[model samples]
Target chain A: MTPIVKPLIKTEALTKTYGSIIAVDNLDLEITEGEIFGFLGPNGAGKTTTCRILTTLTKPSSGHAFVSGFNVVEEPVKAKSGIGVVPQYLNVDGELSAYENLKLHGMLHGMEWGKMKMHIEKMLEFVQLSDRASSLVKTFSEGMKKRLMVARALLHEPKVLFLDEPTVGLDPQTRRNIWGIIRRINQERATIFLTTHYIEEAEVLCHRVGIIDYGRLIALDIPEQLLKRTGRFVVEMLDDDRSKARFFKNREDAGRFVASLDRDAIIRKSNLEDVFIKLTGRKVID
Target chain B: MVGTYAIFWREMVILRRRLIRVMASYAISPLLFLIAFGWGMGRSLQVEGMDYLTFMIPGLIALSSMSQTFSIAMDINISRFYWMTFEEFQTAPISSSSIVLGEVLSGMVRGMLASFIIFILAAAFGIRLNVNWALLLSVIFNTFMFASAAVITSMIVKSHADQASFNGFFIVPMSFLCGTFFPLSRFPEWAYLIAQVFPLTHASSCIRAAALGMDIPLISFLVMIIYSILFFLGAITCVKKASL
Candidate 1:
């Protein structure tokens, strides 16, 4: 007989509303330990609100959330001790050195001085920020600041790390660099709860992906499975004043359809964007 | 407790970086006031049975304590609106009360540092009065009350323009009309009643009595204590609401 294993994160019929508009409606989810779960959504799609709720930054209007076996609303401090969140905005204090910022965070976390110092050093090295440890954060570039944010979030070694659009605004090379950091952290057995609108990021980093639209969870599956379900190939061509996308199960079939068309056409493998459009019967994200 | 210390330590680190500018802020204003008043008209005037300089020093201390402590609101606003660094406190495992207490403690330190500079200026002008435990108590209560008020205002404000409006309407009026330069006896009855409603008025009276070695007004102390506790609670509530 096998014992039941509790998921690291769970939400039960979670709902949130602001006046007449609902932000999140009856979300139910379970993320097992040691898995990278990606929440993908466009702007105003409720991804941020869900992340905020799980990180204990916002309370759900009704329903339950648990992180690391502690109820978020009932035991926020206990739940927060197990969670680390890198918010969408850059919040590192420009007045302090990178080391000082991490030191402040550790102190607020109530970490012992010696242990906190050691972890701060390790995190700086991990983020490749050890060389600029004493430099004020305002002097750092955007990529460097983003790295420092990651180091600060990981300082306490939280059991679950929530990265909200970790690579939202960065060069392609820098975005890849962050992906390596995310992958390495997951290899260390920390559960990663990532929220991003970048479809490629979810495909590359997530073990399972949940796509939300208009404050609802529309799809949850492995990226490959989702793409498979939506068809594997796409042929997009000019149709009147707008471009129309058609999905096919096989590249050969897609090629045959493209040949039959009399207009300029492009054939490509289906991605999360196509899946989102297919599931919602709407155009891909803006 | 650790949360409070961490918050205090963060402010101290930032303060230390701008030590020269901060020291000048503490020294320059009180020096100008002392030179203008004590070396000018205060050289010959007398008020309330004491030398004008003596009468003025305690009021200056009270003013310095209130202004410097309440300057914490500026720091909190910069953190909130520009840096967004206040969210670090919100996201951390610390309680809202701890955050308020921590910020208030740092503000008190700033206020007391400014008061110490005022004492030095007073001494340089040959206007030393005995510094006693009651004086310490008065300054503490004053700083605590204003610091709590600073947190509440910082949390409630939505923008930098709103902060300027708050200072203009609330702090600026109190600074000028709250008996910081003259006695409430100088005002007409209704005017005095309006002035008396401000906590700064009681703070000025309490600090003046404690510093001048006069018969202290126990009622002033009671008024300050009530304002301090109420403002502290309000600060905590404001912080919690801001996070939400």
Candidate 2:
């Protein structure tokens, strides 16, 4: 097999601190080109901070990162040119129409009128917003606005796109629609770096998932590998009135039941939520 | 820059759609100030060669720029937080400098438009069109400078409550001490120092001096330039440090 290329983004001891609290701490990370990398963590686990630093939106307190072969601190504009970010909060101008927004964004990158018009039409169509191209964004539904946000981000044809909780407030159907758009971007060879708390979202969309807790990377691998390595099938039965005496009596039986199964399998209950709790020593808030 | 022009064009179109409200807001205060302050002062003793209305006309023009430009600054923040229009700028490839320039340029356009309307009203009231090219240029330069300063003010603001603080602490004080409603000669030494710190002082003095066809001091011009540079730098720094 051909050797895989080196990472497009590399970080060494990257840290961001806010006052007395550490937002992101001593993180070493690498993200390859043409791959969808998902960051999964509970709220306030520094997922957004990590994304902000990589996108050149916020400066890190210490250490450094490189994007598209340019250092974020030393060559921010070059690094910024290679990235497009869709923040958790909506940033679309309600006053401008869908076309106007895309046109302005394209112009910012110095695209010519002829090429911009053609590209704007194609992108609007790609996001299924062609019908409402002239409608004011303030009049758009949450889903429609979200789609336009994606279209605006893609106008510059950025090599890497960062999305922070892209589907946080959307309905399930809308969320799925956004997922489809993300997948399409991936197919077109744009590397995606998204931060999401939804495990199902990471499992469905990300090529590789990184689980961060307390500002540190705890697990980073394919979703299947994580479940396979740390999770087990759980057999839940009704609790009896036999109490502690019966519980001790059934210990041997439980051991035999576990011994009868495949060696690779363990008779234990564990899911993503369980894994999160086990690692963080706190119950998953949601 | 091309990006700044694009943003400026977009802002113009948005303002066009809200033309009725914008025009109404612009006309309301000048009319009220004309009827109330001018009439109230006219009933009393005559101050100088011109009527109270004529004296207040230039003041009204400067006030409109101050109020409108600062409000535009605040409006951008409100739109970013409540309506989410800021996302458009964030995802776009434009530099923060371009964003700041675009917004300030739009405010400058608005200020000039309102000031022109005040000039027309003053002419209708039999006030002379006292044209001093040098001083008029200074007034305009200061007006644009203050517009940029207002935008910088909004960039540093953390909440809606900051709007009141900005208006009460900065805008009101500057309007008073900067000679928007009175001449700079009436201000004391320390007050003059505080007044010179803002671009508005240069703006109001330049306009007032122009209306009377009086020569402005070279020191005022130098101070305005210094204030303009400081305010422009403040705006750039504010945008660079903004998290959202």
Candidate 3:
């Protein structure tokens, strides 16, 4: 008989409300260990709310959330200690050195002095910030500050790591660097749950993507599978500033559709953005 | 708790980097107050069987501690709004109570440091009041109460402008009217009764009594202890309920 494997992170009918509005509605999720799972959504699509609940920053109105086998609301410290989070915003203290910030985080995680010191050094080196560890964070550039935040989050070596919009507002080079860092961390057998509105980011980084819309999960599958299910090809025809697109399962069919168009048109491989637009009839960014 | 210690340790590291400036700012107001009041109201103007300067020094000590500790709100606001560092504390493995306790302890440290500076300034002016354990206790209670108030205010206010308005309406009035610069007896019966409702009034009264070698008012101590406990609980609630 096949053995039953428990998920590293699990939520059962998780619901959150603010007065008359529901921010997260009856959400259920199961993320297995060692996979880079992405929560894909537009702005205000409840991705951050779910992340906040799992990280113990916000309480779910009703439901159960377990991280590393501990219930988040019932055992917050236990659950929180097992997870690390890099928030969308740069939350690291500008007044503190990178070393001091990590030290403080280690202390909050209840690490001993000797162990924490060693971990801090390792993390600084891992993020390629060893040389600037003693410098104040405000003096650092955006990319450097992001690297420091990554270092700070990983200092405790949490079992599950959450990255919320980790590369938003970054230059292309910095974004790629962070993607590489994410890949490296996941390769080390840590389960990573990341949220992003960037469809390309979700397509490239996530092993599996869970698309959320209006506080509900609309799709969950491997990125390739989602793309295949939507269509393998998309034909585009541009009129003024607005472009209309149609999906086809194969390149031949897509090319035939583009030929039938009367205006300027092109055919391109389908991406997650095409899949999202197909699923919801709305652009991922819109 | 280890979490509390960690939080306080971070505060100390940040404070240490700005130690010189912080200490200088602490001394400036009291120096100005002494120059303006001490020479403005000479020794011939006695208050409660003491020279005006003697009575005013203890008040300055109380005022210094209260103002210094309550200013923790600004630091917390900057962390929440601009630096966003306080979110780290929220996401940390620490309990909400532990976070509040850590910040309150940091406030107490700042308040004690400011009071120490005022004591030095008083000594330099050749004015010495009775110093005892009770004085330290009073200052600790004062900071505990005001620092907890700071946490609540910082968490609830949505913007820096709201914080400024809070300081304008609440802190500024309390600083001058709550027996920090003058005894409550100077006010009318109705105004004195109103001032008595403020925690700062009790704090300044306790500190002044301790410095004057007068009997410690157990009633005022009880009032202050209750205020501290209530405010501490409120601070924890404010932190736990906070979301962005």
For all predicted structures, in order, the TM-scores are 0.96, 0.89, 0.96
Candidate 3 chain B: minimum summed lDDT over ten consecutive residues — where?
A: B235-244
Q: Per-residue lDDT for A1-286 in model 3, tens only? A: 9978789999999999988878888889999999999999899889999999999888899988899999988888888888989999988888889899899999988998999999999999988999998899889998898888888888888889999999999999999999999999999888999999998899899999999988888899999999999899988888777888888899999888777878778889999888889889998899
Please list the C-alpha lDDT of all candidates, in the order they appear. Answer: 0.90, 0.76, 0.90
Q: List, for all models, the DockQ compared with the true complex.
A: 0.71, 0.54, 0.62
Task: Estimate the Cα RMSD of every predicted model relative to the unseen true structure.
Answer: 1.7, 4.4, 1.8
Give stretches of model 2 more than 4 Å off: A1-4, A236-271, A281-285, B43-45, B186-198
Docking class of 3: medium
TM-score of chain B of each: 0.97, 0.88, 0.97
After superposing all C-alphas onto the true structure, candidate 1 shows an RMSD in angstroms of 1.7
Q: Pairs clashing in candidate 3?
A: none
**Which regions of candidate 3 are displaced past 4 Å?**
A19-21, A238-242, A259-264
Retained native contacts per candidate, as fractions? Answer: 0.75, 0.54, 0.75
Clashes of each: 0, 3, 0
